[model samples]
Target: MGFLEVEDLKVHFPIKGGIFNRTVDYIKAVDGVTFSVEQGKTYGLVGESGSGKTTTGRAVIGLNDITSGKVLFEGTDITSKKSKTKNVRKDIQMIFQDPYSSLNPRKRVIDIVAEPLRNYENLSKIEERKRIQELMEMVGLSPESILKYPHEFSGGQRQRIGVARAIALKPKLIIADEPVSALDVSVQAQVLNFMQDIQKELNLTYLFISHDLGIVKHMCDDIAIMYKGRYVEQGTKEDIFNNPQHIYTKRLIAAIPDINPRNRADQFKFRQEVQKEYEHSYDDYFDSEGLAYGLQPISDTHLVALPGKG
Candidate 1:
């Protein structure tokens, strides 16, 4: 079985309206989204804002309710029952986007990092303190800083604190919901590289949700593109980066900043061409309701939501 598999997952929020406030319509935050993560691999979920990439990650970790479908973790259906178990919760962790808000300003660093340990394990006081210290050091924070509050640290350090907290129980999977988007460019690189290093050391699988194509290219082993709550394309990093099949994916790739002065003219021309194709062929990829079609397999590792009858 895959390390983690989400099968036809959907998260719909009901829109209440009228005096009676009866069922009006649903906002399909995640519609039929399906993907899997292997042990020690990073899967990138990339899209523009409001594309439901963040919602997908939240649903995987049980933060958002699943309207339908299954989430399997190591062959067990976590969506239905296993998600409630202490072991399952311990195995799956999340690092939220906003470090400042995610970490409680009222609590000291030790309390924030040790919160997971207290929930899942029955470690002695000394052992818990030792564990939190080790986690701090692992994320490049000094052990002595454990007494400091969240606001005392820099933005990057606070984020690392979040990272330390996420990995406290040595989780098998970590849902990183735009983990670096809140940081500066240089800090983003530092955090991303630190995450990569820890993934190697701890054999952690990551569901990386982000809109930055450059960061996705740097960190992800596989990539999936989402639009309007539906998956448009999914494949290996090489496939998506080198030979993107979906128009949305192509546009995203073309938008990645190219620093080479020599390729300035070529890059601009390529983006213009992609934009033209996207504008002209938009209807070819989406239906009248502006939703993508169901994904169809093009290769063993590649799937695309091409418009037409299956």
Candidate 2:
């Protein structure tokens, strides 16, 4: 089994309407999503905002309630069951999208880094201090500044601090939700390289959630493209990028403002490819169980999800 598995996961929030608070429909934040993450690999979740990327990440971290479906860690289900999640959380950690908001301005950097260690394992105060300082250096922050607060650092440095705090406990899986979106272009690469280096050094599995296709192309081994709470397509990086089989996926790729912008006709062709993928399924195939997420054989290690209703 994969290190992490999300099976038919759904997170729907009730929409209020009418007088006396009638529950109307539900906003399908994450609807019937399914995927698996192998150990020491990066699985990129790509889509526009409101496509359920952040919600999926939060659900995986157990911060948000999963109304249905199963989130499994090493084959054990962790959906709404608190007891099944204890050990799983220790191995899994999260880096939030905003570095500025994620940190506690009141706490010292040292204590922030040691938070996980304090919660999971009862380490001696001295040992925790040593490990926390080491983690600061590991994430390119200076240990001398451990006593400083979150407001003392710049944007990039704050993010580095967040990264330090995330890996302090030596987690196996790190869910990085746009970890560099708040930084400048130059700073973004520095952070990305830092993340890649740590992944190699630590053998970490990352569920990288981002809308930036360019970053996704560089960082991900496998990619899943989401649209309106559903995965419109998914595949190996090569398959999804070079030969995207879904309309939503194709459009998303084209949406990446080309460095040397393509001509109108070439751009038109790209749009067509995207639209073709969005086309309805043939009579032979029926969408399964609202199977917005599935494995259509593009090749080994490559899969695409088609839009159709069973």
Candidate 3:
């Protein structure tokens, strides 16, 4: 079995309206989405804004209530029973998108990182300090800077601090939601490379959720493309990047800025072609309401949402 398996995961929010705030309809944020992550591998969840990437990550980590479905960790169902056990909580952690808002300004770095240790592990003051220091050094931070507040650090430093906190408990899986999107380009590489190093060091599995295809291409082994809360395609990085079947996936891949000046004209032409294809073949890919069809396997490691099945 895979290290983490999400089966038909659905997270729908009630749209309350009218008198007494009665439930009018449901906004299906994550609708019947399913995927799996092997131990010590990174799986990328890529899509545009409001595509349910964040919601899927949140639901897996117990931050949001799952409307229906199962989240299996190591072959055990942790979906409904996450809150009942501290061990489950300790095994799964999250690194949020905005480092500025994720960290509490009022709390010192020591306290912020130690929050998980304090909650789950019965460590003494000295032991906690040592652990936090180890984590700080692991994430390329100074151990002495533990006494500093979140506001005192730069944007990249704050993100490193957040990374330290997430790994403090030695979690097996981390749900990183656009962890480096807030940083500048240089800092973004620094943070992404640092994360890769720690993933190897700790043997951690990452569910990396982001809209930046370039970053995702750098980090992910397997990728899933989402549109309107449903997966349009999922496959190995080679399959998705080298050979994208879905029009939306093709469009996203085409939109990635080509740094080489030699390919400028060719790149522009390719994007135009993909845009024309998307406009003409819109109905072929989507239903009447414009939602992606269910996933159908096209290869051993590739799946795409299309109108008909083989």
Candidate 4:
């Protein structure tokens, strides 16, 4: 069994209406999505805005309520109230998107990193401060910075602080939701590379969620493309990048910006062709309501949403 598994996970929100605010309808944020993360590997959940990628990560970490489905960690079903033990909670943690707002501006860095330790470990004040200092140093920040506040650092540094907080408890799996999207282009690589280094050193598993295919290519072993609360395609990094089957996956891959100016014209032409094909064959992939069909296996490791056999 995989280290982390999500089975037919569905996270729907009630759309209450009228004066009484009774349940009217549901927003199917994550509809029947399923995947698993192997130990010490990165799994990417890629999609556009409002594609429910973030919601999926949140649901897995217990930040968002699961309307239905099971989230199993290390063979234990944590979605059930009785089974989600403290050890399970510590084993699973999340690094939220947007470092600018994720860290509490009011609190000092010592408190931020110590929050997890306080809950999970009974450390004395001296021991806690020493541990926070070590965590700061691990994420490339100075041990002295633990006394500072969140507003005192740059965006990249703030994210490093967030990382320190995430790994403070020595978590086995980290749900990193768009961890670098909010940083500048120049700083994005630094954070990504540092994350890779930390992952290797700590032997950590990651649920890397992002909308940037380029960044996803740099970081993930397996990938799943999400749209409208469902998966359109899923495969190894090579499979999705080199042999995309679904029209949506092809379009997304085609949209990745080619940095080399010499190939710009050719890249533009290819993207235009992909766009044309998507526009013409939209109905062939999605149903009348504009939703992807259930996934069908195209290969051993590749699955694409397609019409079922008659």
Question: In order, what lDDT does every prediction score?
Answer: 0.92, 0.84, 0.94, 0.94
lDDT of 3 by residue, 1-310 (tens): 9899999999999999999999999999999999999999999999999899999999999888999999999987889854565577789999989999999999999999999988888999999999999888898889999999999999999999999999988899999999999999999999999999999999999999999999999999999999989999999999999989999999999999999999999999999999999999999999999999988899999999998764
lDDT of 4 by residue, 122-216 (tens): 99999999998889989989999888999999999999999999999999999999999999998898899999999999999999999999999
Q: Write the per-residue lDDT of candidate 1 for residues 67-108, one digit (tens) a residue.
A: 999999998777854435657878999999999899999999
TM-score of each: 0.97, 0.89, 0.97, 0.97
Better of 1 and 4 by TM-score: 4
Candidate 1 residue 235 Cα shift, in angstroms, is: 0.2
Sort by lDDT, top down from the best: 3, 4, 1, 2
Q: How close is candidate 4 to the true structure, as a TM-score?
A: 0.97
- Model 4 is weakest, by summed lDDT over 10 consecutive residues, at 78-87
Tens digits of per-residue lDDT for model 2, 1-310: 8799999899999999988788999999998898999999999999889999999999998988998999988887778757757887888899988989999989998888888888998999898888888888899888899999999998889999988988987899999999888889998998899999999999999999998999988999999988778877778898898997765566677766656555767877777665565465422222544435454666776667643335
lDDT of 1 at 181: 90
Global Cα RMSD, each model: 1.4, 3.3, 1.2, 1.1
Candidate 3, 153: how far from true, in Å? 1.2
Q: Which residue runs of candidate 1 sit more than 4 Å off their true CA positions?
A: 81-84
lDDT of 2 at 69: 92
C-alpha lDDT of residue 284 in model 1: 91
